[model samples]
Target: MMIHRLGTMLLLIGIGALPAQSQVAPLAPSDITNIPPDPALKNWSVRTVQIPMRDGVKLNTIVILPRGIKNAPIIFARTPYGAEKALTGAPSNDFRLALPTSYADLAAAGYIVVVQDVRGRYGSEGDYIINRPLVGPLNDTKVDHSTDAYDSIDWMVKNIAETNGKVGTIGVSYGGLTTLYSIVNPHPALRAAVPINPLVDGWMGDDWFHNGAYRQSFLDWVYRMSADKSSKYALQFDRQDVYESWLKAGSVSDMAKQLGVDTMPMFRKLVDHPAYDEFWQLQALDKRLGKEPLKVPTLHVHSLWDQEDIYGAPAAYAAMEPKDRGNDENYMIIGPWRHGQGMVADGSKLGAITFNGNSASWYRQKVLIPFFDRNLKGSADPGIAPVTAFETGANEWRRYDRWPMSCASGCPSRSKPIYLSSGGGLGWTSPTGAGGFSEYVSDPARPVTYRQRPILGTYNPLTTWGQWLVDDQRFAEARPDVVTFVSEVLTDEVRLAGQPIAKFFASTSGTDSDWVVKLIDVYPAEYAEAPEMGGYELAISMDILRGRYRESFSKPAPIPANQVLPYEIKLPNVSHRFLKGHRIMVQIQSSWFPLYDRNPQKFVPNIFTAQKSDYQKATQRIWTSARYPSRIELPVMP
Candidate 1:
């Protein structure tokens, strides 16, 4: 969703994107498809204004109001992307409101809809800071996104006409981050907020780095939103095959030079700090949330398979839920969606897999509409559940008073462990003897492709890279470098409702390495209901751990060659059901490129600065002996 070379497609910008929290949001089907403008919009007036901040910088804002409506509650959205065209430009006047779409419904329901460009973005005055850090304990002169939101809301309520003296904020991706920031220092009139797929932590998850593993996708993203806010592809390459160009460009640092990144401040700053240093830590919104949760009621929505920003929503909800227990104000909804797919009407499918119903439409109508109506417009409570999520294999939606419904009180959910045997078998029994392990040679020059084909730019609408998380894992199933462990066909359903922990007894032939663990659900070969579902290898949850950072992210030390070590890789929490006759699988590999930048098997002070010679082929081992058993711990559901 980040502005790309195609010249800032307003609907596409931040539709499904993030940053170091700035990764680009992806476009939903509705974004590209055209619908005719609604005749009802003719009754509404469009006004553009330069709203001033405390520091005197002005933001470009657009207000759309129904002429006959008065005392309407204000529905506000702040975005880093341009607001003018998206708010007014359109074929289907209904599409004007952008993702959380249903503009016609909101307008007909009587509300003052407003959209504004965040300071430093298009038509706004000020320097832009990507994922601007939330300034804690700031003086009146100190400014941050939190202050910007506060200032804007303060001005709107005081000057804007025909208001019910109430305000609500909502956005997806970066705008979601802004929504999160808005409530960090909320305005008096701000009644409710919904932050969809917001980037909660840039260092551990979400946009740039994940547990010290730098995502190359960040580079592709930052390039699209350069200092001058132009297209990265236009500035760098005219060629379509981006993968070949990236490979030819060589190392991570070298790619910067090829992109002519001398003027791209964000890229420079990012490469300079490759670790989870203070720079990334400061931008993390979850850490900034602190012990005392925000007082404002919030509904945090996210997709289970969101290519970007997957870690933010649940993390933010968990952090706040404990403090706001029984308040019925903190809520979360996770679906089988890609980034920003929650806003699309047809959310039943992602690539080859399909859910039974239109999940997105149900959410918008049954949840979002009622949530705002009650909180912002003083209507009856919708009585929504605290957690509403979709179960993948089951193809159904479930609600809970709390997420991951604990089994302590005889709930259906349970936790089970599946061990890796000496052979390729996955079973409940642990290995008996000593010195049993599986080894594979990982060649840096021949790294496994993150996807089946060439890697594309992050914003390429033509590519399936955006939904690669849910892509068929069979692409890498036969690769020699990947070690596979398979479980027998299950007799009953096995539902995983929480985080799955990977306890790996691993070693490398060199000083440094990377461990990528994938928890997969393999369909039987004779699957009949859906032919494409037959032999499907779907990755339920997966994560990587940089061997050097196994000890500390700040001080990445090398591993002793051939000495086995225990590594704990906590995959993102998943909601899935492995049905009867299906087999569970675990794939262990050394590299997943260029989804994650290649890790030099040899120890280096910094991977970003490593020379070509630093990259080496190493034989990685996964031990399953009784002395050091490796297994996957699943939060099973009853």
Candidate 2:
């Protein structure tokens, strides 16, 4: 009976095993679809092709055309960033959905948009050089950004069947730099160009170094950009706080070594040229383009609070204004925004400050699109002003016949000096006392942070580096190393419309030092609207200058210790009003860490390679007496 029961169970198991054998036989390789069907675009068709350059290098170009549309003008953009990624994402019927926020208004207007990867980045062929210089002394190669842009545009007009043979270029930051390059020797088809927050200069104050201080925070970006051809690799930090990591790394050289970026060609170039040498001067766009006559109807867009390329647009505008004989070819727009904020973000607000309206949207719909239409499509004139600037405190847009109306070479603006007095007082009158000074001990070990602590990496998604320029300045108010001077509450609105110059009469105990000057707007202590802004210290224009470069930006010299000298620091441009009932404040400090590399008190041949021993505490003095009047020269608008 037991043997018969076992046989029945074995028979059932055999039946299950037969099914398993069939499964193991791999029945007909299941047909599973991996890719989804392409979306039927209603108004747009996309295609990518390799556009050959004059050098025979094929550049990856993405062309987006308005379906059923004919003879549309081409809006061309050349960028080191991926062209494919810029215009492609989840498939959609509405082409506007795939377009970047900056191009939304342009896309709705019906035009062929072309984006190409610059040489040696993403899918483009040829070597990638940082801010590739024009075909000149710095660039000995047969092809530079100028020639490549010309070649690409030449090919674009001839090959693109739907294009009207008229092209306009637009881009931000490095893209902006390339846009400016395209117009150097513009193609016949190139008509209009817009360069927003472009990198016009590096050694003077755009990207790499500001004045003589190295922007060490950009090293991470350098590493990521130069790491791979596709720019896919990101630099990973072991510590969560970039400030801590960078501080621990000591010198810029040490930081580069620790981050394994010391071997990068850009890094090596930075280390090799610590001064404003010919290498940097040769690549300065403002200097190069300024000398040439305006060939394209170019509109330069500047941001009042641009953190990355603050010195670019204004500098370039000043350089090119001489050539704009009719004040028609060269135009400028300065808005209240961070770097490239007007391009991709709603400019209504930056950090906690609100501008009350969508400044960016207004710029696009009202100014940008119309400008392009008139230039590319031969539409009616937009009648835009030569200069359109957004006034911050007033929260209003103001049009001017010319920018910096107060202080340009031919403008009517006059620079008036506001003196710093003893006992933390600041006023328009010069100091009367013969001898008075404010003293502080500047320590490299505990340098004043540029912003709130735990600063994130420059390129981190959640990083506050973009908005740090607009952050409240109260964080550095109570620090011992920082000296504060305040003016009485304003009875009337004080409007400044141009660059503010910091002329310091100071001395340092150490051979070398750094000076940071901030012009701040202090709100009333109590406020009904936006209570959080009460007593807020908003920096209007601020910058740092290494003492070594006080005499000349290109040269470095040790200070005559304990002897007061005149230090003239040129702060970035500003268009702001110190409203009635508010106060003006000026904070002076010796260091702005992580943002700028620390300046060792003891003079070293190169601050990048300064040793731990070179770093030292120094006694700094700001003399504000009649003999040594430390004052800020403001282009006060009447």
Candidate 3:
């Protein structure tokens, strides 16, 4: 039975004979290829090929055969991540093995699948360069990602004689990034592609940088642990706390001794460059920002709560000019998930919330298999109206032709701002009567700690993926050590799409003070239910914004403690159908722990080097009004 994929249905409706139900068979790893496979699909052979790249670097690749046939349609996945069967392919239904998935999924579907390890990591050859060194005055010898992807495709096209020549790429995370990178190059053989949770763009500003201010709670450092190599520095230092731990554990001398000369150079360099600089130039992947818009069809599957690359995915997708976003060639799917894996960011249990199903299953059944079935097999696959996303709070899937907004004729005339009045609530008018701005003393010595603790497999000390974002204001609520801001109840549903920006006008008594803004959807009642196991949501959903690069990310300077400084940070992209009976809420604070590190009240050269004595609590003031109202601006869709 064939499913009416996105294309076939569009074709049928074009010819007019359409009252049909979609046919879909949820695929399982066991259903992949049986050494002989079930006679249903067809026969295929396997071949091993070595692909060479620029400068003579070679990558080991595997080609899946189709019924011993020659020159058939080929599907490609160029990945630096290995394609080891036991580790890479699909696992048992119970996931008794590693990841229950593999290249077999594609091969079994009747398409010839080609898999390769990226240069330097697995079987591929070449010196790994996470921070590609500046060899010449301007260029770096280390082969960049673009050249790598381009070279791999060239090899597949010329050497892989049986491949009908057409190739489509797919992968998650690193592979996803490569897929996105591949299309930018305009390769003739590469036509259709899927970049699942691709690390598309923005290293600093996304989750790691958070508008120039680093997300302490995010474990960007530990990832250094698994970079191109497991070297002395990579092993000795936990990227998450090298700066802070070195200062606290008094391990500088030991660290310097352990990392010696060769290792610590790069880690130390990053600390010094704090803001976006030349160091991030060759290292960041988003450099391909405006590369020629795709000439072929594409499917970009990204996760919303993904700890690693959410910022890049949506930012890159939304950044496309209208001209570049034409046709079904480019489709975007974002699930409430963390990093490159899983669909729902939440396992459905946030302190008290729980979602029953795993997003991967749905993604496999509804999106993955069906998508390929339509494009490759020319089968009848369902249109895009099916599995767009499950509104976590509402418990349902909503579909639209495009993301961000649903057909914006012109920013809705109904746009309005809900002001933050006195008494910690929102209203239409500026609560001048609520008096002046509230203040908090930020102390570096006894700095308010970020509540997140270390988890088992967490490489970064402050990785806050899969945590709670509730009203935990009791500790900092009236404390002089924290800043607070609140908005009034909304009279109507502020349907929103796109990203939110939290702008703050603040002054600190110390050289530096961390500022965070959160946009909350205040629900109607304490709608707590055993079925909705995830705590309370009369509080709805929330997102945060940090302040450090208020002026710019490249430079850092103290605010002289009390002088006011205005800063704005970009929050994550969101799609919420805030109902009419709900209220729009926003909160501002200086600290959000284990998820982020504590900001010692003092303005020191580095956050990690500050001492307990330097943690003197300083006063913080927030300014608001129609003129500079510290606000949360969202993309309101119809």
Candidate 4:
């Protein structure tokens, strides 16, 4: 039977021969699709059930089984996003629905596809918590995502009609979080898992916070989640200008008040615990996984330019991969795409950079399919490497036995600092004479925008904000508050892999400040194949550090005014090759604008409580002398 038989019902209702259900609205004409379901819904069976959890909460689940297949290996996905969206192609009110990339492919191969809303989400019972903490020592009373997944799989193997008991879990982003959780203490039926761009640590890096700097874009998320919306999609502001609205709010505390904090318990918890207290520590995946070996063959997917969750994939792999070192059970794929771009078929070009071919399609057909076929179906191994990564500038895929690839071919095993010099030069040699430092005044009132003007909602796909990573940095060029240092055109191709560390010997005139270091690749001025590529300042890797959290995240202390301090900012790992004639550039600024909340300059107990008076202009200096040689350490590949 058709899941939605609205066509005939609509015809009958139009002629007044039948009555419509009060709660059910007919499908919109625009939603009618000639695109048939994979394996054809006509040849499959759809079942929606509330699977009982250990704690008695029933998770809303949808199971699609191919009609003629018996004992089909199950491909399961759990998300906070509604299961109905994943089932019938219904629209979700939640954040953009999890990418439905290779779902059809799996279903077409006679796999039983399962999608579920985790406990406390839509159509489920229990109090919803973001990044639910693990319940150490599993018991009947203790219920977490891991236990829930174990229970769900146990119940499915016995209750479902399918004979083949093998199961695999895969998800992207938050869904990826659940996928990761399932692997910690997995069920016997769980054979494989793929977590793409998962948010690994709550305190250090990911969507919520970077270093100690809180990501301001998530305020939009908090607002939407607080409301009684159908799904956790981004809240649409009444006003067209979100940037101006945030500017007027003054502080995060004030913004909460404007959003009616009484209704938002999560927002309250977020600001109340500004530091990395027990709240965030309990949620860090790395700390929870602590030396525990992975339970299954895992495939980790990542993108170097991922706007969010840039630190999760690599961090999680490093934490759990040691257990599988001898067996080659843990694998990773790093691509030159944006957040979750590896899921879809559009990895050809992002902003001005092009990958030359459909990378996502290739990954789906060759990498993903082969992995699942071998692991879940007892087929021969595809001979995948431990790490398959795409080098950006060189734009080629390379396989390695280990990540942070061992320097077998004379590639530098360690990083060496390239010193910053006066006259806007960057080189391996340190500066000698006077004028050895660069100075700029950072004013919170006139903070720099992270992207070009008219910055729209990030969750919405129609906006230009998604391509900010690959955007040319010339937009901020010549700004009084922004400082730029460049290296001479490379004589030969300079390839860099692994982490880029920014070491700054600097002093701020104020008590508190924020330091943003962006490692950039400058296209030659004469290059003009693409207008956006001409003199493009593509950011390869960047990081921001709030000076107050320099020592410890839990105990933040202000710097002594005008006292120089050594700050080491570890940027996310990257794989890129700066071709000959391309200049290596470094851009230093105090604010990343709406991307990160502006630092008040003056020290406050809590930044959320900081008043407008706390915001001040501060003169920031980057010293490049022999005594204080400020530099960035690049992991060069020979």
Best by lDDT: 2
Candidate 2: segments with Cα more than 4 A from true spot: 1-30, 34-41, 88-90, 406-411
True-structure RMSD for candidate 1:
13.9
Q: How do the predictions measure up, each by TM-score?
A: 0.89, 0.94, 0.75, 0.89
- TM-score of the candidate numbered 4? 0.89
How well does candidate 3 score on lDDT at residue 414? Answer: 31
Q: How close is candidate 2 to the true structure, as a TM-score?
A: 0.94
Better of 1 and 2 by TM-score: 2
Residue-wise lDDT of candidate 3 within 26-123, one digit each (tens)?
A: 67758555385444543444566668777898877777655555655567776655654423433332222222344445554556777776666566
Alpha carbon RMSD to native, model 4: 8.9
Off by over 4 Å in 4: 1-41, 88-99, 136-141, 232-238, 261-263, 407-412, 432-435, 459-461
Worst 10 residues of 1 by lDDT: 91-100
- Give the C-alpha lDDT of model 4: 0.81
Error of 2 at 171 (Å): 0.9
Compose the digit string of candidate 2's lDDT tens values, residues 1-638. Answer: 99999999999989877855466555567688677656463667778999998889999999987677788888888888899876654456777776787654576787788889999999999899988888878778889888988998888889999888999999899999998888888888899999999999888888888889899988888987899987788888878788788778899999889879999999999999999888888888998888888889888999988899999998888888888899887889888999999987588899988998999989888888888899999999888988888889989887777878733334576789989987899999987778689999999999999999888888788887789999999999989999999999999888888899999799999999999999999999996788988999999999988889888777898998999999988999988989999999999999998799999988888998999989999999999998998999998886
Q: Write the per-residue lDDT of candidate 4 for residues 1-638, one digit (tens) a residue.
A: 46368877777787685455645687787966788545442556668888998778898888877667786788888988777776544333211232255676677766788888888778878877777778754222488889989998987888788848889999988888999999877899999999999988756889888888988778766666556434555565545556776777888777667756535777777787888887787678867665676778888998898888898998888777667857478888888988888877477988878988988877777788788888889889888878788889888887767678563343444686887886788998866665467899999988888877777776665677657887778887668888889999889887787889999888999999999999999999878666646787889998799999988888899889998899988899888999998999998999987778889999999997899999999999988787888899988776
**Backbone clash total, candidate 3:** 62
lDDT of each: 0.80, 0.88, 0.55, 0.81
What residue runs in model 1 are displaced by over 4 Å at the alpha carbon? 1-41, 92-105, 136-141, 230-239, 405-412
